[model samples]
Target: MAKRIAASLVHAIETLFVIAAVALAVALLLPRLFGYTPYAVLSGSMEPELPVGSMVYVHETDPTALQPGDVVTFYRSDGAVVTHQVYEVDAEARTIGTQGIANKDADGSLVHDAQATPFSGVIGIAAFCIPYLGYAEAFCTTPSGLLAIIAVLALLAVASLLLGKSGSRRAGRRARGCGNDG
Candidate 1:
């Protein structure tokens, strides 16, 4: 009974792991087919809405189409990519004012050069996000992580084969014992 229970538990765990891995792969790959780019959130600026380690999908859009309340990813003068909510748009000047949801002030002020982010700096508007999956994507891209995945798959295959062999052996032994008792 204990052996049966252990086998069931292991099978359940394997099933769950496979489902999770497939889901993650779909989430990361499906968007790319539709021209959406994934960017990992590295800060708490967009917290609650976009937590750290989340993967945000950005879709490139026309600058003139952007409006207040739209969330967008843009390049900063310093070369950093920032994702923020548009609080204002100046179509004439081709600039957009943005602010992080968690911040109390806009991204800039008159004292800070009095300039809104330029339309040319806009990369794309955020489409959707998957929390904590960015970390998985980042890790899976590394050499060590890929090797670890391969090792795990090999181990799982070996374990399944061993379990099958042991189960068949036990069945054969039970059949022999019953025949002897007859």
Candidate 2:
């Protein structure tokens, strides 16, 4: 009974792991194939709709095509990348005003200020977001995280080999008893 329970537990774990792996691959890789750049959310500026630790996929867009209420990602003069909702667009000047949802004020008090990041600084507009996936992306970049991933893969490989051997042994035993039903 204990052996059966152990086998069942292992199968359950393997099934869950496979499901998670597939979901992650689709969320991370599928967007890249379509010209979407993925950014990990590091702040709660756009909270409620886009919580922190989410993975926001962005697609390149024309500045003139942007309108109020559109979410955009752009770089500041200091090279800081920011994602915020468009508050206004100045076609003649080729700049857009943005503000965080959680903020009480727009990114800049004046449209001509740093908050009005130029069209040239625009990286892209956010297409979609996957909540809490950014944590996985951040963790995977660390040395310890890489080691942990390698260890898990190794364990899975070892488990698969062991399971395959046991399955073959069972098949062999059944074949030997096929004509010995006396």
Candidate 3:
């Protein structure tokens, strides 16, 4: 009964580990393939709606479908990417406009021209946002972050190899003992 319990415990641990690994891998890879980019809110431009340090998952979409109050990421005329709320969208003229919530007046110029293509021009829209998750995501995407992950994986591989060797040795010893008794 004790042996059975031990085996069950080990199996449960292994299952949990596998589940965690799969979840982490999926979280990291899903965005890259689905035209989603996660961003950390760095400013209070869209205050009362999205705050700084918020982790937002943005998905690319058609510019024409954008509506007022929709938070979006767009390329400015100066070529800098900015995330703000859409204040107006002129479907007839093909212009997409935006403004910061805290700003006293609307932006001086339209952000996206009517001729602007769809998601071809958009980076993404927020699908999910968690406050303070940006730092962790940013750290994981850095050069040092990647190296740290590689190092940990290598360590796990070595540890698994050692554990497997020990387990096999124990199994062989048990078999030998049973044969001697027989």
Best by TM-score: 2
Task: Please report the candidate that would top lDDT against the real structure.
Answer: 1
| lDDT of every predicted structure (CA atoms) | 0.84, 0.83, 0.67
Q: Give one digit per residue, the lDDT tens place, for model 1 in 1-182.
A: 66667677777777886997898889888899999999889888888999999999999999899998899999988888999988889999999998887765455432221348899999999999989988888778789988988887787777777776877788887888843322
Q: lDDT per residue, candidate 2, 63-109, as tens digits?
A: 89999999999997899888899989999999999988766545534
Listed per candidate, the RMSD to the true structure in angstroms reads: 4.4, 4.4, 6.8
- How does candidate 1 score on lDDT? 0.84
Question: For candidate 1, which ten residues in a row score worst on lDDT?
Answer: 105-114
Task: Judge candidate 3 at residue 163 and give its lDDT.
Answer: 63
Q: Model 3, which residues run further than 4 Å from truth?
A: 1-18, 25-44, 51-55, 77-80, 90-95, 102-121, 124-127, 130-136, 178-182
lDDT of 3: 0.67
**After TM-score superposition, what is the CA distance of residue 57 in candidate 3 from its true location, in Å?**
3.7
Q: Is candidate 1 or candidate 3 better by lDDT?
A: 1
- Higher-TM-score candidate among 1 and 2? 2
Cα error of candidate 2 at position 61, Å: 0.9
Alpha-carbon TM-score of each model against the true structure: 0.69, 0.73, 0.57
Clashes (candidate 2): 0
Name every residue pair that clashes in candidate 3: 58-125, 59-125, 94-114
